[model samples]
Target: MIELNQVSAIQQQTQVFNQVSLKIGYNERVAILGPNGAGKSTLLKLINREIYPVERAGSYLKLFGNETVNLWALRSKIGFVSQDMQEDYTPYTSALDVVTSGFFGSMGTHAHLQPSDDQVALARTLMKQLCMDIDEQRMFQRLSTGQKRRLLLARARVHHPQALILDEPTSGLDMGASLGLLSLMRNFCGEGRAMIITTHHIDEIIPEIDRVILINQGQLIDDGPKNEILTSEKLSDLYQTSLQVSQNDGWYRCWHG
Candidate 1:
């Protein structure tokens, strides 16, 4: 559902992507894997229209078959959940208000932009599915890291978007919380929706995500099926170290040899 043709982007006066080209299809599960400052976040911003690529010959970016789209309309088609979003809400914002605000793409509910009863119900249902119903009236800043992440997940899915874009989704969680969030992501994709994940951890690349795109130092390193691209040799070279990679039950892991 996204097409980038020789696209290059710059952020903060630094080039983040150089002649990057790729395609992500509807209902596809893919991961943009890379280390810190590897342009992974920049690429996500490009897709989310938070940044623009440098214009040059034979370079273009398109989303959903069009070069330009209304941001409001696009939000309904692709839900984005990021760490920055979790930090953007006011400390006193209620958990329920955070989810319901998805309808207006706001950080929280305000008197002038309140969510309707149906929207509130939808948000509650999503929170319940994520096992976060108990935190409905709790203040946003009072919850633990995992709870905040799940609340953001509910916020993203409340609109029933066709696709979800998650950035570093499980960065700061205990093992149980991380796995729980990953499981929830898998269930979301099972409902005929697409998922595009950006992460540096191999464990976060769920089994349903068959495609893995490796990026390092603002350049595309590799793009192919998971089995082919996630080999010991490939990962070792990507991370610039001696590493051991293993797979079990379709899950892959890597560590120093």
Candidate 2:
């Protein structure tokens, strides 16, 4: 449900994307794979409307068939979860409060922002569905990293958005936590929702994600089905290092050749 035509973006005096063109459709599962500092985050920001592509000939961005949309309305259609958002919330905010803040499109609850009863109930229901079993009143900062991530996932889905955009969905977690989170994501996508995830790790490309887009150094490297794009040669070139790729039970992994 996103279209970028020869789009280029600049952030902090650095050109993050150059003539990037791509389309993500509704109910599609795709992964934007790249290394660090590879413009992955910048691309996500552009989709989230947190940044804008530079004006140029034959370059445009469209979300849900429109060039312009209200940010509030957009959030209702696409839920975004990122590590930056996790860090943006106040440390003392309660776990449940963090989830309810999604109604206000905020990082955390403010004194003046009052969520209605139904909104709060939805947030709680989402958390339960995600299998987050922590006390609702616990401080966000006190929760484990996986717990915090799950809370953010709940917050993102509180509005029952049609799509989810996740950046480094499992950045800092042990194997168990990573798998748990990915399983939760797969369940979410099973509900006829689209998911666009940006990740460096090959294992993060869940089996449901059929399309894979590779980006490196602010340029599109490759785009195709996961079976074709995630080969050893392409992944090695994408990371600028020798890598041997293997797949098992619909999961892929890479290691030094």
Report lDDT (CA) for all predictions. Answer: 0.91, 0.92
Cα-based lDDT at residue 214, candidate 1: 95
**Model 1 misplaced stretches (Cα beyond 4 Å):** none
Give candidate 1's root-mean-square deviation (CA, Å): 1.0
Give the distance in Å from residue 158's predicted Cα in candidate 2 to where it truly belongs: 0.7
Task: Estimate the TM-score of every prediction.
Answer: 0.97, 0.97
Top candidate (lDDT): 2
27-81, model 1: which lDDT tens digit per residue? 8999999889898989999999999889898999999999888899888999998
lDDT for model 2 comes to 0.92
Clashes of each: 1, 1
lDDT of 2 by residue, 49-150 (tens): 999999998899999999998999999999999989888778899999999999999887888999999998888898888888569999999998889999
